[model samples]
Target: MVKGYNYIVNSFFDYLENRSKAVDSLLCVGLDPHIQHLDKPSAAAARDFCLEIVDSCAKYACAFKPNSAFFEVFGAEGISALREVISSIPEDIPVILDAKRGDISSTALAYSNAVFQHLGADAVTYSPYLGSDSVAPFVRRPEKGVFILCKTSNPGSNDVQILESNREQIYLHVARQSLVWSKHNNIGLVVGATDPYALTRVRDIAPNSWILCPGVGVQGASLKDALISGLRKDGMGVLITVSRAISGESDRAAVAAELCDAINRERESRKQNHTVHVTNNIAVDLIETGCVQFGDFTLKSGQQSPFYIDMRRLASFPDVLNRVSKEIVKKVLDLRFNCIAAIPYAGLPIGTAVSLLLNKPLIYPRRETKEYGTKSSIEGVYKSGETAIVLDDLISTGGSKFETINSLQKVGLNINDIVVLIDRQQGGRKLLDSQGYRLHAVYTISELIDEWLAFELIDNNQFILIKNYLSESA
Candidate 1:
């Protein structure tokens, strides 16, 4: 048993991470197998239900959690169905036995053996009330994990969990104590999504510990709140369990994929939102510093715009321009290109700044090839097969950038991506994508304007006026 436990420990975390990537999902499907939810009244029907769910959603799940109470109520047949369901799951994706068994010493030992040895579950949920000794047997293996029920999903959890102890709440004490108990790094907490407030506290208490988050679907827990609070620093390590949410659906696999995508989008949105706020703050400062102007300004396209941003004036503020240049260079360097080229007039200074900062060669692609002095379209010592990232101040309808792309491609420069200070969102992205190029921007005009309005830099009428103009232009 000890030998087998060591093997399970060796593969658990790695298996979880690898399987999650393979499945392209972090949702853990819970197999509770309640009798009424089954198509038929018999235990075989229950077994088939669980089997079908595992078969369908296994490829879209990181783990499968089987709650023991739902199975044990039916006695032997229920237990048999549970065993068959666990055995049917893919070996790489772990199965956590959600048995909230709470006992210390010898009793904990026997339960641990039943869960790990007899049943073949990689992890189990156990009560932490009995202290470290209760969970010691389970952690002795180091590969398997034990999730303590800190602040559960139900409303009744506060009855005992929230009771004050040593001037700290009992739940907080249990949350903090899990760290001391986590000698092997196998400690986790069963934080209910319903109690996002408590879940948040527990997460802070054990940032690196795995959190098995339930109550997302049937329990009506806030998915947004759970994601904001429960995610570990790497944007993962939260096992979201949904039983009826995935299983009850006719298209369970599609539903699982949607949920998985939503979870990842939420994580990504956090990082993106932080960047937008930071960059938007910079844009606001640039405007206040006279680099950008907010008024009726006629753009080069002969269209009236409420705001005008000029990259040339960035030189007026060295401290801000230095930060802006660093940001632009960092983004351009990420492209891993040999050099950078910009559109003639507006993009010259920004492109030169990026090139000098990144220590890369710079080129300015002319509208037409020069009649003399090399008679070249692109003015740079670039060669064929060498890549160049396009730098531009802003994109409007993308016509100018499109012209630059064509001229570069005609002269033998590789341009697969463009870095812009702002995207006008006037159908430029679609055009760029159609030409097999990616347009990475610090902000879209709409995104910047929205930030301006949010920060009260623009009045409601001004905001509405810009929105109306954008609609008319589109």
Candidate 2:
């Protein structure tokens, strides 16, 4: 568990290394299973062919990405075939269910559950144009992941994705927004290898993000240019995907192996490409960790807030927790605080994570002191005359803010800066500022509400209601 995770290695890294291992074995077969290519001319046959390809390629390829539409054509039978095909593959080689689905809350939840549970996918693809609600369900689960569509290998993708806006390509908008989404979930970008420029721009926006790049083989995207455009400074961010050129041929296993070799060669060619500014990569990661939330909820001040934040969710998601903790530490790199204290159970995990990552001592005040031990309200390493940061997931009226600060002060810690994950902006910031405590927040409920509104994730009435509530609360 590097920092705090059950998995020793990162999922993306594992997928990459797993591919490398499979390449050494010589296999990366694409399970397209077009009905025209199948001998039996049935959904079950398609499934059987896919499983056969997996059986043949598992020894050669590290992972399999199954395009959903191929099986969707068969209706219920096709869906069953798809499920069986997924389950038939060797468990060691991860499966990427390539279903580019994007929808709102309930619908998105059904899609996510279908992909992760019914289809048994390690990860699935998502379209981010709908806003956060569409993408939240996948990330909420600890094991699953979401790969966002930034740019595609398809020529028609340029029709909308590459159109100019503010001198920035439409694809760049997708890339930048995906960066924000990636902060909270295991977000990666799907940038086709065919467009080097678009790929580079996506990389610029998300340097640390793993790219699942298609068009490497059949689409005529050169291994040379892809290596040049796709490789990150670390050499591991690019997942060069090839489908037809490898899968369309006889000796599917041998072709898969050859493709893997081709990817490795490309990776070696672009080994020296330096990474660009990815300042918000880790911050976005924090948001994805289920540690961040954006929705309507009542605050302690009896005010209806635009969004509610709960960073404690990070404790259950290691990737998100680590990403957010690291980013928070990066944001506070220059600041000096004598002690770290969280607002009871909610903020304790983040506080502890930051404290450990920064090598700074930690002290969290409890809602109430324990009856046993030191009978102290504060725990861990605390000291006198030291300045402290009050850590809380969300702040509403700044009512509890004083209570938390006072508790820390009682233990001889100086209280000033309050680091909150979300600021309801319903007097919390103003209240903290009036008390001479600088309020730092990752995001505001209003900002989140605006995002929801812009994406049409919520109705105008909900937006107006939230606005009226905040205005009335203020």
lDDT of 1 by residue, 322-397 (tens): 6767778766655778888887776787788788888899988877778888888788788887888988878878
Q: Which window of ten consecutive residues has the lowest lDDT sum in model 1?
A: 1-10
Candidate 2: tens digits of C-alpha lDDT, residues 206-239: 8778788888777787765565555666556677
RMSD of each: 14.0, 21.1
Clashes of 1: 1
lDDT of 2: 0.71
Residue 16 in candidate 2 has what lDDT? 46
Tell me the TM-score of model 1: 0.59
Q: How much lDDT does each candidate structure score?
A: 0.79, 0.71
Residue-level lDDT for 142 in candidate 2: 41
**What CA RMSD would candidate 1 show?**
14.0
Native-to-model Cα distance after best TM-score fit, residue 97 in candidate 1, in Å: 0.9
Clash number by candidate, in order: 1, 15
